[model samples]
Target: MSRTILEVTDLRKDYRQRRGLVSMLTGQGRVIPAVDGVSFYLRENETVGLVGESGCGKTTIGRTVLRLTDASSGRIVFDGRDITTLSRAELRPLRREMQMIFQDLDAGLNPEMRVRDILREALTVHERPSDAEIAGRVRELLEQVSLKDSKLANFPSELSGGEKRRVGIARVLAVRPRLIVADEPTSALDISIQAQVVNLLRDLQKNLGLTYLFISHDLPVVELVSQKVAVMYLGRIVEMGLAERIAHQPRHPYTGILWSSLADKQTTEVTRRVTNVAVERERRTWGVFDFEQPTSGCRFAPRCPLYKEKGRPAICTDPASEPQLRDVGHGHVVACHFA
Candidate 1:
């Protein structure tokens, strides 16, 4: 078995929201739990996909795990070392081994610098390589990410969207990172370009033995790239399992609804897989709930079709009886009262 590379335990990241002037004056704000008790692990050279709707904390979890953002509570273990409380100086050395590919195409690229200069900066961050060594590594990075050497002279503003993305990836690779948190890497690309980038990522992972915490809303792509998929809802993972099982045999109602909705969108018709008239009705009527005013018991109970199908069971709404993730079988875990 491959060794576990990253382990996050009950990770929580909260952001304080101050709405009006009165709240800001009083130095008081409502705490919003962006990542509420998220826990998962990634094995060496394996990919674990984190999938959810927008604002469901997928990006927050990715950032928190990399220590790009501090966690409110919980532990983040990277390469078996507890880095949750590591100071900036201590974390600096570890940064080379872990990196994030932001969702933005131009995230790491400096507009003022050419692609070659940008890559040189990343290569020299942790260590001072000689000029010759830097030149050689720069060539290798461009080849690794399938970028033409001629494009190295162009600034980020001169490059196309796909070229900018490739340059961003090359910059990350210059550090020789083992674990990469890819935040919606393909979301911003054109449909034709998306496939090319996806293939490039897969090839790089296979050749370099890279581990990834792939965060995206594209279910099909997640299923393609990830060994395991954890489905998040309202800042918490409600279902987690092998990619195939989570896609086909989802236990949580939210998971079912998610896949079903995707199917509806693709086929442009009502999906009979996991949704019907009642579920559609519930989805249409479901009210938006946030972390500030979380509902009692299961946060998903308000929009769950199963809750209504069971005639509104009190346990599903009881504050003391909130559902917890329990092992079903074959490493599948779900948080539902009647899963």
Candidate 2:
């Protein structure tokens, strides 16, 4: 049995949006839950992919896991210890165990700093090593990330997109983190470069026994790296299971639409159905104003093709009858009523 290294229970992150001049004067703002009641666990040395559309709170979930942003309310347990309420002083030591790889290397890396300086600084912050050890460690990290020593003196601007990302990965590894929250690490790279980075990450995991919470909007990349997959929609997980099962035989309608949208051929019956639904809607874009925001019930029901095909069932719209995740079989869970 795999040991659970990280567990998130009923995690929620809400942002208070400024209403307007009128509401501001009235002292009222709306609370928007970016992540609402999400729960999952990651096993040691395993990769769990959190896949969702752009604005489905995937990135927020990562940030909250690392405590980069404060969660509204939830339990974040790391290594069997509750970290949700840990003070800054208490969390300082635990910081070395968790790290995050950002989606944009430009934003993550300090453009003003050279690669050597960046790596050296990260190492110094966590622990004190002798000068000789620091130098040897730097070389080892560069070799581990497959970057040449020549790039050490180069600034972020001087490196290619792929090289910058490699540097980002190297910096993360310098801390010897046990769990890495990789948020779309290859989204900015070319297709060929993306594959190289993905392979590098996989190899590193095998060699180092690292656990990863890989977050991405790209279905194929997620499938390539993940053993398990979670599909989120509108701040909630709609489906989750083994990576192959979720990819080829998704139980939720939203997952089907996402799979069909990325399909190379619409030959299968399910693919045909998803393709039709895709055509009906213009294109899925993330924003509060894109579709009617559901106050309750199934949040995806407003845009779900199955809900429409079923003549807009009352259960879908009723606020009192919120759907909970149920196991279909073999640990495959879906939140859909019709699934």
TM-score of each: 0.94, 0.92
Q: Over the stretch 241-278, how does candidate 2's per-residue lDDT look in tens digits?
A: 99999987888888887777776454565345454544
Give the per-residue lDDT of model 1 (tens digit) for 135-237: 9999999999889999999999999999999999999998899999999999999989989999999999999999999999999899999999999998899
Q: Which stretches of candidate 2 lie over 4 Å from their true place?
A: 19-27, 264-292
When summed lDDT is taken over every stretch of 10 residues in candidate 2, the lowest stretch is 283-292
- Against the unseen true structure, what C-alpha lDDT does each candidate score? 0.91, 0.88
The lowest-lDDT stretch of 10 consecutive residues in candidate 1 is: 267-276
* Residue 221 of model 2, lDDT score: 79
Supply the global lDDT for candidate 2.
0.88
Best by TM-score: 1
Q: Could you tell me the lDDT of residue 124 within candidate 2?
A: 94
Clashes of each: 0, 0
The TM-score that candidate 1 achieves is 0.94
